[model samples]
Target: MKHNRKLNIFLIIIIIVSIIPLTSCIKDNVQPISKTEYMLGTICTITVYDNKPESVIDKAFARIKEIENKMSVNKPGTELDAVADAAGKNFVKVSKDTFYVLKKGKYYSEQSSGAFDITVGPLVKLWGIGTDNARLPSQSEIDEKKSLINYKDLLLDEKDSKVMLKRQGMSLDLGGIAKGYSADEAARILKENGVKHAIVNLGGNILAINTNTNGKPWNIGVQDPFKTRGDPAGGLNVTNKTVVTSGIYERYFEKNGKKYHHILNPFTGYPMDNNLASVTLVTDVSIDADAMTKNIFYLGVDKGMDYVNKKNGLQAIFITKDKKVYVTDGLKGNFQITNSSFKLMDKK
Candidate 1:
């Protein structure tokens, strides 16, 4: 009986020792927290590496939802709707969120010399791009709507947090910059909650929280303009940065064998015609990258590169119609061209 008891005790000691290593391994491998939702007319995904991921993720998403409710023009009774309703009549008092976004949108409009305009809302509604009603508009209609698309008329009273559209028919569309702003806000929330690693993908406006959990830079693929979605023309390795791509491929329609894309020129009231197919901007803030992309796209490759070069801390990748890729100096080593059919241009 004594020998049998000794053997059982020895076996118990071995079992506990074996279980320790397994438990330690499991504890070290923390699964990433991921969640997705439909918002801002596209899928917004948030993934974070955190000890208490649920709380942080919920807080991050809440901020995005708050922005959408206040800024979305599609949603009736929103602050944007109130401003549009009072256009040419009175100033609409808006929440701080709406005021900040509109203020920044107007700033971009001025910086781009009207190349990017938020007041293009009137024209956007006329074309109805991305909606089932999308169709080619007659020149007369285009001209009429073009008259209402001026960013200068968007008045912002910062002291009182108000917005006023100067003309009766004028409207404000935050679609261009809203998603990027939301992504930035979500990232801010994540960091505030002690999340060290995360990825905020708001409709492909990607903001990497920091380096990947593996301690390597995040690799983001730039979509191929002519191919199906998720097809990569190149990849960028980045850490703690925003990568946003504005391409003709994003929203478009086919009519009479010709393609009409959503990026309209504020000046011409027609789709911006630059030979370039897509422009990707990398910057510290997703909002700036998102707002500046259309301006660069309208500028085309040459002037676009000049604009990107002059801006401190901004890098751009311009993919042309002829399958040539022009990358700003900052991205030379960081951007890898994955598609063999595309040629990386030598420095001009």
Candidate 2:
């Protein structure tokens, strides 16, 4: 989905804060600096707390660069590009990392009953809603693409670490979950590198490792789907968790006075028109949370909440187009609603 508000401003703020020094020690004569940057089509903010020399920060950046090289679609030989190229062709043997991501995609597809599909790539390419070449495809075009879109059609050979699309013209787009996966991977690398406290923000997918240097939960703001530009719509305080959101207001194109968003429903081959404006999921696993946000958005408010409530260790915040907010029972104590425009709905 296309963000109605200009995201450049928010990106700037994230970039600036990511580079500033996180802490300084007065007694030990130590200076701890945190380095961060925006890469891989998402903002990655890495904050490390350590008295180690600048080499640690350099290694962190080096790891991030490695991830960017491996996972980026822009890079010709990357695994993502390989998947894109192998679309409609033979099975593509991917790296273990890529296989793990596809495995999570398939898992969520089953969990959400096909609401979140990686095989919706054909439809996404057809609509081109988020790109400069955005347009509404004809019914026949949508139908043809829909025939090629199904997660069940994706065949995974675990032993060989290969991915195959059952039919011709089928493709896989990891856009929905790649950011979160990268964040999780980056955080894992930091932890392995002896960085205990860190935050990885890949745009809407925010993941925290351990806690902040202050021993407090990391504060994450949920971008208001309807709020005017430059206003805070309140946020959630989370510790060692992942918060990912999928909203119709993110990216889209307008045609015939109607908005066509980037988030396509695999069932309808079009953007979801449910009452929900956005869906945010909180979980220990950012990959699952990322996939679930898109799934819940497509599932609509009622079924989405039902799905979250049924799943253990999952909490969600739902915002309807009419400005109504609903929080699952699991989130009752975890999140605080600060927007007067939002009203909490009681579970039935």
Write candidate 2's Cα lDDT for 1-348 as tens digits: 333333564754543342222233122443445655657654455655555555665666666677667665445688766666676677888888788888998998888788789888788879876565678899999999999888998888999999888777777777888777877777777777787666666667777776656666666667677643223345677778887877765677787778877788888888988888888898898878888888788878888888888889898888888877788776676666667777767764
Give every collision pair in model 2.
1-250, 1-251, 2-250, 2-251, 2-252, 3-250, 3-251
| Reference-based lDDT, each prediction | 0.82, 0.72
Model 1 worst lDDT window (10 residues): 17-26
Q: Per-residue error at 299 for model 2, in Å?
A: 1.7
| lDDT value, residue 156 of candidate 1 | 91
lDDT of 2 at 321: 88
- What are the RMSDs of all candidates, in order? 13.7, 3.9
lDDT of 1 by residue, 263-341 (tens): 8998999889878999999999999999999899999998999999999999999999889999999998988888999
Candidate 2 Cα misplacement greater than 4 A, ranges: 1-36, 49-77, 80-89, 227-231
Candidate 2 global lDDT? 0.72
